[model samples]
Target: EIIAAIEGLMKDPAVGHPLKGKRVLVTSGPTREPIDPVRYISNHSSGKQGHAIAKAAAEAGAEVTLVTGPVSLADPVGVTVVHVESARDMLAAVEAALPADIAVFAAAVADWRVASVADNKLKKGAGGPPSLAFVENPDILATIAKHGSKRPQLVVGFAAETEAVVDNARAKLARKGCDLIVANDVAPGTGTFGGDANTVHLVTPDSVETWDRQSKDGVARALVTRLAEMIAKA
Candidate 1:
């Protein structure tokens, strides 16, 4: 069934010729910043959306590479999957997997990491607790978007905002120097993180397209179709 779907996409002129022979890269899941051997900081991303995008792009006839953070999902057929744990690892992995025609930053990377990693578990003090300092992690999306060589022709970013979705998304798009930004609310009651459904606003410099809440697969198909069109025109 999956192969048949991919064959159908390959035969579809609108999606086929545009992505034919092109290389695409995608990032997914949550980066784990180690606090200790047994603990880490990460997000709630399930990597469903990113996986779907990789599948769709492969169906569209592109050579796809997925740089994923920790996730348990099976790798999509016809796509190269590189697994990484920390935000720094993800960044390095993505840089090494470059020369892609399009790059999608879909991973929910942690903003900070423990400044110092203890060699062994720290025991609680008699008086109080340990103070762990944190440092900012590299912004993967911004870094790839601004790379000098082997830069993707098109760069897209995901803005998982909790409030002011459109405004924050717009800011992220501009700040990250990405061509498109998919902004979605992850507030409580919204089934975004680890959920099958999503409601997102696609923000570009010229316009904003708000999509009705839909399944993650639906969103992936829609985004891939649009990407095919954009690449065809480019």
Candidate 2:
């Protein structure tokens, strides 16, 4: 009876759960830009952080939709998962899952793709190395964040930087038109790519707040709490 009373005291006074009935959309991992059937351009994102966030949001009672790129991690429980490969595919999936209450874009999408893909693999001895042209990929975060009709009420982006983390995040928050930017240092020795822990800075239009190093799951829970509070106040 005591434990039940304590739990009841800690529960939200309003909604049963903080994010009850809210729909959240999250993009995770790294989008690959294919060069050939066997080769592609991509990054080192493990989807651990993004997956953790989706899990935490589900725990918080939000209806979560996780749109992910190629990654090895298993899908989070109680969340709808959409697996995609290239940047274009990810963008299309995100568009199809629109009108969410909050959207967190955590995928490290490839910036460029080969302009012309070879039907056959270009051999090393072919013309003494073939030159390739590249073109920019669609900016998914910016497109969704600035959407006129289907934009989420709150849009968050991630900035993985090697230097000037907060400064770069601030710039990205403005450029991407997102409500917030979660910036982290993924430099050579940061162990942020596939590691368990992370140190992040929450950059918004008004200020920046730094968070201590913690496990990816811990960060996810903390972020969910913060977002829930923000929604309550809004």
Candidate 3:
């Protein structure tokens, strides 16, 4: 209902289209890295938070482009959706949707991919356990945040951590060259992987804002408003 709220705000005389002319790009879900014809590597992200953010941005009157990975969620209304499968595909899609005013890298992209994928599923015979080699995937956030010409004015990234949440996020904010980092604890039993609610800490260069636990939609709405205000000040 966060997007619906934006519609409500639009009708109010006091609130206009704050992000009307802005271009927003959001990345969501988890990319799959192929291991074999029948197998792949992926994560447990449900795309709930990212989708909500995209919807919120669209509702706020921004021209939104959502680059997403495999998920079961429906596409957010009034937004352009680009579906991709792997980290490479996601990076390509993000690069194509360039010069965004705001970019949110919410996707839990794989850190590594299989070096060589099998053409066919390997049979479990006398070969025992097969050795699989891996290589690092492209750092999408870093690439976009460090872009020279096509860089978005504001770039955001997410840190799903089980320990040292704020510290790790702070490090990531600098390491990835992003303006903001949304950090959350995804330790087992947190119900963060597929749950609707989120407890997040927004880490920036100046300070950190820890928001109370709330639905993903609530967080999205608040974040969108905060970002719009920041852009306005800039």
Q: Which stretches of candidate 3 lie over 4 Å from their true place?
A: 1-16
- Between prediction 1 and prediction 3, the one with superior lDDT is 3
User: How far off is residue 207 in model 1, in Å?
Assistant: 0.7
Better of 1 and 2 by TM-score: 2
Q: List, residue by residue over 1-234, the lDDT tens digit for candidate 1.
A: 999999998778755545778899999999998877777778899999899889888887789999999898999999999999999999999999988999988889998999998877767779688788999999989998888787798899999988999999998888988899999999978978999998989999999999999998899878988887787688
Output the number of the lDDT-best candidate. 3
Per-candidate TM equals: 0.92, 0.95, 0.94
lDDT of prediction 3: 0.94
Instruction: For candidate 3, write residues 146-199 as lDDT tens digits.
Output: 998899999999999999999999999989999999999999999999999999
* TM-score of model 1 (CA atoms): 0.92
Off by over 4 Å in 1: 1-18
**After superposition, which runs of candidate 2 have C-alpha atoms over 4 Å from their true positions?**
1-7, 10-16
Query: After TM-score superposition, what is the CA distance of residue 6 in candidate 3 from its true location, in Å?
Result: 16
Provide the overall lDDT of each model, using Cα atoms, as 2-decimal numbers: 0.89, 0.92, 0.94
Give the clashing pairs for model 3: none
For TM-score, the strongest prediction is 2
